[model samples]
Target: MNLFVVKLSLCFLLFSKITFGQETLEYKLNIGDNLIITQVATQEIVQNMNGSKHEMLNNLECDFNLIVTAKTDSSYVINFSFKRLKIKTMSNIYGELMNVDTSTELKEGNFEAKMFAGLTNSVLKMEMLKTGKIVKITGTEAMIKKMVNKTGIEDEFTKELMFEAIKKEYGNESLSRSFEQMTYCYPEKKVSVGDQWTNNFSGNLIAKNTWTLKEINKSIILSGKSNISMNSQEESYVMKLKGTQETEIIANKKSGFPELITVTSNTQGTSITDQMGKLEIPTTIKSKTIYKTKKYVQ
Candidate 1:
């Protein structure tokens, strides 16, 4: 379920509060406003040489939802914990939040946060309900677990590396695939847009990464890359990272806000390249955020 890993990364990250009673939420983090973690899966297709493949996309896309609450009591800090008990083989997608906000700064205060895992990459994240700067990181469980102090994660594998892991564990046919979860946080990001930052994680996985914020149009976009690989797919699982993803939010007239995020995942791997047949995944990838924000408060 390589698609599951990829979609899990996005779905877990997008599991915000929706107002219309859908999987999304619109509630502001009040003193006790709760957050829900949802993982959405839909039929996935792999680009082929001629066109695309859509054969067994049946119930392959399974989605689950859960509720989470912030444990932090301050507004100027980042904190969260991955409940290892949630899933034995999966991680949260909180590492991606680092890109959502890069200008966070931690003031004098104390903070603690917690993360939970649901089946199918579904997980929840909650920080101290803060009216000040709130950092958000979104990624898989591994990344989410190690990301900043906003999130942290270390990976040395590619999506193809992950594909091979799937082939090894489940045996080819392309039935299931998974990868390390990623997490990042900016408890305090107050640098200018052009400023750069770097961090590292060491544990079951070792990872290093660099990041920069570029203000395009009127939005401050987040861009960065991590050296991820298949360190030990031996008896466990591994994910072949396609590559770095550059993302930006564009304004949606109908939504009255930037509800769309155009993400370009830059990666180069044999399997990914071969999947395209003759075409290429392009040096830059172009994808969209699953959900758009109707309104946001800083």
Candidate 2:
């Protein structure tokens, strides 16, 4: 399920916890603060058209180097570095469609993607990557490639058009369709992980998603996790996901952001056998990240 939403979110890559700089950390993001994004996705999508449940697993490590511009309005120019990118699963693990229990770690390799946008009045510019992530994953990761293409039009449209696409995509109602839903919202008067915020005015966080808010210099930080139930006609499913997330906070002198968080997350999931349980193969996503956001810009 987590993989489902993360993959679903590929259609929409956006950011910030609303109040902008004011997160768990009491301080406001100054010019040097950088916004970091580390995503760990482990999905086991098993569709048995032939009355068989097969699965696979994917473990990838991605990191982004972001420099919060001196001008707050200008979005940070980030160079996305794919660290430890690999594919592993018990089965053939051929296509994006996969089912698995354990994953095989691969040799270390590097890939890259870059995005340039920060606090622009134009939402679209913020939505579209400074470059295209489409071709990058297409041949190697076809399933994800489909997702990138199916949604988020970054074509010849003006900057304004791209943003409009993002808003409309997020606003879609189907986004909430998930099992054991854990949505993240923020209270009106400055809230943190322990605080309560409704979906409507949910700070910068959208509704029906699992959010990880750690304190970066005493401010609420924005991170996310999501679980999605596959399109299964089956009635019963035994699902299990065990993983790890390591977090940190640092004041990056270059960006001025109060924290550089790294979530070294990895998990393995397996569905207990049950005729009534429909959820299929379980998987784990391993991620190692380094993100610096501006909270106290020196």
Candidate 3:
């Protein structure tokens, strides 16, 4: 009888240990929370034109601050503001090198006349879920229009191009899609460490994302793989892009907010255009982007 009692006690302890070890973590939003995120990226692009190769190196940096103003049972209303944007590009075309920087003031050429000087300090409002899904983005179009008007671009052609590009990039549909990709792709149900889920995105490009909860130490780590098929047509060109990307996210386990995120992607594409009369140029692009975040006030 004593032996049977000992065996039963051992079984209870084992069951309790297993249950405690597999406890799930739940994430919810809180008002008055602020997170500042900074992103930096560098890209190497190679294009073949008329049996010759041209290469460009591009660098980009941006900063955003997210402030939660209100929260419901299932969602949060957040205000996102951009503090800075900087882009620098270097290209060697036909043995001549040229550089363009958006943060610098240009004195001559159409670039100077149409430069986006007021792109910084833009703000957008968002309705988002605690699971990192964005339901809607507001005030983006108005902000873009304001920035364009502030440029005071003199040339009509350049002004039109700039306006169109900014609108396409920050407009509601595009911004929503972009924000979706920024998530770690959480599942609908509560998940424990080592859980996995798949996220799909459809837009000008279609990408299949597979994300896994990799680790749970003091912080949580989420890793992902994305397969991309991109196609887009503008007035000047039609581009088809195929690529693969790998992503990693490190989050504060208590708050469920990301502290750092990294993404690396490699793509190859063909651009068909009339720049040289129905020309088809093959291109390759590789980029690595890192985002770091910290707590902020206001």
What is the lDDT for 172 in model 1? 13
lDDT of 2 by residue, 1-298 (tens): 5998997676455334444544332222344444444434443344333465555545543333333333323222222222222333444435543222111321122111111111111111111111111111111122223233334336645434544433322322222221002111222245444433322212121233343444444343545443322222222444455444433444332332335444345555555456635545554435454444322324
Q: Estimate the TM-score for candidate 2.
A: 0.33
Pairing residues by index, what is the TM-score of model 3?
A: 0.84
Give the 10-residue window scoring lowest on summed lDDT in candidate 3: 110-119
lDDT of each: 0.31, 0.33, 0.76
lDDT of 3 by residue, 190-258 (tens): 556777888787777578988888888898888999999878888888888899999998887777777
Candidate 1: lDDT of 191?
46
Query: Which digits, one per residue and each the tens of the lDDT, describe model 1 over residues 212-273?
Result: 65543344344545553323334323223344444343432221223343433333332233
Number of colliding residue pairs in model 1: 75
- Can you give the TM-score per candidate against the true fold? 0.33, 0.33, 0.84
What value does the lDDT take at residue 216 in candidate 3? 87
- Candidate 2: regions farther than 4 A off: 1-27, 34-38, 70-188, 192-194, 200-298
How close to the true structure is residue 201 of candidate 3, measured as C-alpha lDDT?
75
